[model samples]
Target chain A: MLIWRKTMEMIPGGTLITATPEEGRQLAMTMARKSIGAIQPEAEVRKALPPKYANSPDSLTAAAQVVALEFATIAAANKYWRKNS
Target chain B: MLIWRKTMEMIPGGTLITATPEEGRQLAMTMARKSIGAIQPEAEVRKALPPKYANSPDSLTAAAQVVALEFATIAAANKYWRKNS
Candidate 1:
């Protein structure tokens, strides 16, 4: 969470979004249409885990991977937006 | 700095304040006057160190201390703000 926030701050005017994975997919689609894709879905990643497994080490590792993927995807989107917008 | 953002998010509408130590001291004093004391001085902490020493491990360690102290101070102020605000 801390690293995610730091990474978010590096980008300007980044509004953090928290949503379910379904909502995330939807929002990502919407942002894609507008060429604005910098959503940080840490909330969805955590929510998708079972309650009993939420704070387990495996869950934490999985969450890290989710965040990393989001960062890369968002970075690519921003690069595209920069070139086109 | 990342820890600071997560800590700030724990509180609502906390726009991070990045300022010089002198400015920080003044702002802390002003916030103190308003009975708002949750100002993180990591910027000031980093600036106060010599430029050559900025990226050294010691500087990083020092910055971490400043952030920790700020967290403790802000948490206390928030406790007070919660009680009084």
Candidate 2:
């Protein structure tokens, strides 16, 4: 029983293990946001630009794609919803 | 007239000048995508993960925010859609 529990907790190639899907989702967004900041450090510029694309569906879709990409990476790292057990 | 046209083409502090809003939008998306790629180079992983978040609003919103942030930076650099006269 002890070994089984331990095995469940340890994902072979997983880089992270969240307690819930919500946590995992948030983590993925945070990672994505941090990555954007890494390349573009100007907060003021980022703040001023959302309104321009707020009504543009194409731009929003493009942005969604990026977010999805980040989430995918996080999902893989967490072994696709496998909890920390 | 010639000097006026030349002056119009040169934006004082602009880093880029697109021919139209469509072009600017495309450029901004490209920059955002490139930045994401720079931070996360695993093409296979990115390709596999978007479908997971396709139905998640929060994730999509977060992604849009990042794209908007990138668009904002690009807009500032391009002087807010200022065309190359």
Candidate 3:
């Protein structure tokens, strides 16, 4: 039995989405579309998506936590020494 | 002078925030608030956020790219293994 959780909330407007892992993923894919470093094309990567899917849910969640921290740290760094850097 | 960029767009609503490095850090900090594995009590960790802040912009940007791809891959995974996992 999968329990859907509220993972991300949109800014500007305070709307939120609560999703099962499967549903959460679909939503993530939609948000990431065509962003910088985005995947080239879904049609091109169609083969890659299937076999490797669902290999490790816990690991992925853990990885997201780490990455989020790292990104936050980096964003924090951009604050200093503007005139010097 | 810092160049601002569009990093994320809120879902369910297409609104976006364009931010310079300093500004972006503030935004990221706000979103990561109270998230699972989120930093607890910004005051307790205020010291941590300040000293380590703005360490590397290029690296952060690169890290975000890799992290984005990794996240998308994980999201893609949830699409599978409903019956098995």
Candidate 4:
């Protein structure tokens, strides 16, 4: 249940992570490269995952799917707040 | 470069669309089911895509990656505005 913001993904038993649009993009690109400290290896995260995630065929792909929802949730909420756009 | 509410993914050359948080969730879940009219067949959209998308390993996977930024942007922007999250 750890959350830095409403747009964060709970990293199973590890950390709840939040990122800007820019940082998220960078994370997706460099996740396999180890270019950033915030991004963890798929294997490392996978090892400690709850049963729900440990069973996925690809953790990175599953993570991307889960993370995308947070992004869309923010996008939709703002659209409601702004009213016109 | 087609966009909707600064929180939408460009559907190659189709329409600019926006949705609520709930609607986005529905779109993601029933995307393969044809449960809603707005969700299109992946193959149909694939046919109309630009050269960049026509070459992807999986357009749906690629799309989830792109759409996430808009969600994160809205999430981050609101966080900046709220200042206490």
Candidate 5:
């Protein structure tokens, strides 16, 4: 059984500081999408695969953790949502 | 302009050790997909958005860097591809 828990460990500190939380959120999503593209370059193939695990709770939780982790990193980088002046 | 750079910093060390590179690769992709799902739960929306940036070199490069960073972490965790006996 391939357990996904051990693959990614959250590292403290983010490299990019953004102007706002919304900017950070959008950037995080974009990075996530881009990462997917890197793994599977073919958009059609990616389109066909989501249904397989769309409703799987474990997968969803794992995915949310991934995004949350990314978002947290962005937030931390921006000093907990401090807007760049 | 939302510059995508500096949001994520590469963290050293992977938590998961796999039996093989192939397993690690699959897990990486799965994680990537799940992250996307977390950001955009609607499968239809995700399906529709790929074409807009599929051919964008910057996005692709960023995506590839994301995957590469992930793979590097996994590889490091597996001790440079050493198989678990």
Candidate 6:
């Protein structure tokens, strides 16, 4: 991941990758796959920001599904972590 | 990616990752996320193999959606790659 980060530093909007760990990996891998020697300038990162941070009884439930796929993958790969998600 | 492959070598079913590039990344990142120092020897890789290779006009259409998310993410990040899936 570090190499991916460093490799992306050659591009213009590269620093934007530090937004979040998940976002960073997504940016890094995308760049690496394209073999783009430098970060593509003007790249945009669109996100549906926190949705006003629920602050309701359902907040926890909402957050749980955010990374459902990641959790599922982890659970599937490690028996100790397996559970019905 | 290479580092991921090497790190996974210590895990029992680790070599199973090389089955496919997409599967390998999924395996490596999943392993790295869990910090499972040694590969989970009994880990299983479940997959819904190609459904008898469509061998029909719709075959191409079926494949177009398999990596829809990846292409969407790539397009969302790079204007040059942008396209409606």
Off by over 4 Å in 3: A1-19, A22-85, B1-43, B58-66, B74-85
Candidate 1 lDDT over residue span A1-85, tens digit each: 0111122222222321323344334433332211111122244543553566445676455434334433333333233234333
Q: Which ten contiguous residues of candidate 5 chain A have the minimum total lDDT?
A: A3-12
Index of the highest-TM-score prediction: 5
Candidate 5's C-alpha runs over 4 A off are A1-15, A83-85, B1-85
TM-score of each: 0.22, 0.37, 0.22, 0.24, 0.39, 0.20
| Residue-level lDDT tens digits of model 6 in A22-59 | 54345434433332211112122112323443454454
Q: Local error of candidate 2 at B10, Å?
A: 35
User: What lDDT does candidate 4 reach at residue B77?
Assistant: 37
- Which residue pairs show collisions in model 1? none
Model 4 misplacement above 4 A: A1-85, B1-57, B80-85
Model 3 pairs in collision: A54-B77, A76-B54, A77-B53, A77-B54, A77-B55, A78-B54
Report, for all candidates in order, the number of backbone clashes: 0, 0, 6, 1, 2, 3
True contacts kept of each: 0.00, 0.00, 0.01, 0.05, 0.05, 0.00
Tens-place lDDT per residue, model 1, B19-78, is 222222223223332222233435565456554432222322333323323422433333
What fraction of the reference structure's interface contacts does model 5 contain? 0.05
Candidates 2 and 4: which is better by lDDT? 2
Candidate 6 lDDT tens digits, B39-59:
222233212334233222122
- Look at candidate 2 and give me any clashing residue pairs: none
Docking class of 6: incorrect
Q: Which of 3 and 4 is ahead in DockQ?
A: 4
lDDT of 3 at A6: 35
